[model samples]
Target: MTDAFYDSHCRVQAEKMNDLAVSDPKQLVALSEQRYEAQIRNVCSYICNNMERSHIVLLAGPSASGKTTTAHKFRKMLKEEFYVNSYVVSLDDFYIDQCRLPTLPDGSKDLETVYALDIDCIHQCFDQLTNTRRASLPTFDFHTASRSIITNDITLGDHEILIVEGIHALNPLITEGLDASKFFRLFISVKGEYSLNNEVVLTHEDLRFIRRCVRDYYHRDSSLERTTGMWASVRAGEKKYISPYKCYANLTIDSLILYEPCIFHHFLCPLIEQMDPKCDIYPRFERLYHILQYFAEFDRHYVSEDSLLREFID
Candidate 1:
């Protein structure tokens, strides 16, 4: 049986828990943080301890689900016992340039689909990494509008680990004949644990939508309207390309927390305020404003500017 905490109708029970302790909201926040951290450590330990040989641990996740951040944390833990050398291979870096990629039914660029990546090149990189002692990785330059495979070689001795985190890492085409024992798989998703006044539950996709909106505005030089507009297509691509392969993973990490939205609100609310009142996003702005009202205020005074959350909020 599914834990009551994770049930599909968990929102109603969560509300009951909220009402039962309405006088001590801090207790819920603290307990949620503890659960979140424990989940991170548990996932990391499972991967590091369960592997029997040198294998490419495939960490696949939807966008802004803290895949990159969690990879960093997991590497830190692995280093305590093994001479681990980790490299983050972003699928975004492997994207076929906009000009060369496939066109949508409307003639616009299909930026979110697997067709945007050079799958053959990706297969080559994995083959090289697994077969040879030394390999050079490719780096994609989004700003310059080009890609050049890095020719410098990296040699990994024993007691080393290679972690590849991306949208398609679990896709069979990426690593076809590799032994199952040689490759451990993980699927990560930003399944939000927050709710609307402990009533209307927030879905995992909702958290990702907010994370993408914050990330696109800050890093990709995209506007809230543009990110919100493209989200449906991005989500469709995930359903088609990413979700089907999730069953293949050995582990699934729920990168959700009750506190993150509260933390996110601190940074994202002000940016939403800057949107033009006359724009189409005004209605969304109202919804975002309503959400902000529910969270107890977070003082971002402690949040580091270099933090991954900064990638979204800044």
Candidate 2:
């Protein structure tokens, strides 16, 4: 969990990735898949063993740690044991309207900050679930940037598990005054302890930056310049909104792929090449480019969708 530990591991993984790139990328992908499955199994068992009464599990993690995807996978695995199902409620649906929200430090809309969430409504939702009462939830409208509590009702049936995934899911403000015995918490992060040459530490932010670069370009049609420019603010918001409550979890999931940055380099480098000189991305581009030079690239086809990195890379 210290920076030094992660940095050292990043160096070892980078060297390992270099060796795998030249020797066998397929084996490297297989290794990542194995680790991903093991992590899922570990967390699932922890939940099944510890969850006694109502199974309201709070899944918290840094951005891009495959929390949503892991929820889906965990639900599937839980069904194999019993006739139970999980309801995934995204905190994204609770966001306050962007038009009404306050501005960010750099004057852009601070959409990701916890202040943008309506605390009272979230508390009510948790209350409804815990009490076994029917309650309609609010859905945020991204297009018009508004919110409306659902008029339709949903009653929790027998054997229903509520799996909430979000940046602020662990904030005590969201679950304050609730019975601690009725809830379980898990903290997840791309605790990638990979290193390059044992000197440079590959922080989670490094992995996330590349993921955002690829996702922004491919999915959002955003240029690398824009994503790179917004990174500092994004990180600041996460620290403010998500990180402080990590210790509240009963379990932690390390969602990291040792050889991922190698695969990410293939997609990210080309995108980096397109950034204009005047864009604010030049400094990070130069730094990451130097980092990329230390590790070799691998074929994209070797990567599996089950890999923790598939959230961004796929």
Candidate 3:
């Protein structure tokens, strides 16, 4: 979609968020959910329209933009609506083990860039999948920080789509020597900024941070200290490596659900309230705590189990 359309929707959603918070909070939740579902359908339609232009989709998004859920949902919609079968693969499984991770000039590990991955292996899998219609993909164990046992070879059925999703999926290095026509490049992001009385309360960055914090703490067993501490480097990596490559995307999806903050505030506020003031990450959490209060929370159980918000809150 055009920048104009995205900006326009951001403004409209912000206004709707503020108004619906008071007049009809329930409607706000339903409408926001509907908007997000429609956006996913629109993305599927776009891909369907250009089916000939692409079969291999490279999907990427920054942390907590719901890239994983989006891919799964997109895959589901493509099958349910269009009767297309697809397979989704992640770059995390392709990372070289932490012990063997590449280092910088100062000898510190450089884990942020694409080079940290088994690039040749990725190319091999992609090449094999496209040419031979099958390849065995590896799995990575985050707890062990190493590649797991290899899985059985997977085959791409005739006329089926293959989706690769990760932060670096759009990087030119991954696409080197690949045919552009057979590949569709898709990127996910949150472009909305929620405001109140003409003052901005939540930014696109803040939305992602909140998502990561909730997911990190509740789902990943990560403390606020760890999540906040790593956020700076994570954002720096996105700016340097991910956003720069978005211009090459066939479509960049704005994955913001305007009502997400409503649900998030319920879970995040209690955690923030318990944060130790003397902690190093307290200041960062304090800022978000202030922003979270602006949102009028609703019953989180009201949300669908399969909702994209579940990616963060589950």
Best by lDDT: 3
* Per-residue lDDT of candidate 1, residues 46-125 (tens digit): 76575546546788987778788777766775775444555555666677766798988999888767768888777776
Order the numbered candidates by lDDT, best leading.
Answer: 3, 2, 1
Instruction: For each candidate in the order shown, give its overall lDDT on alpha carbons.
Output: 0.68, 0.73, 0.81
236-299, model 2: which lDDT tens digit per residue?
8788878898988888887777677778778877766776767666877877776777767887
lDDT of 2: 0.73
lDDT of 1 at 120: 78
TM-score of each: 0.82, 0.88, 0.91
Error of 3 at 63 (Å): 0.8
Collision count for each candidate, in order = 0, 11, 0
Give, for candidate 3, the lowest lDDT window spanning 10 residues.
Answer: 1-10
Pitting candidate 1 against candidate 2, the one with the higher TM-score is 2
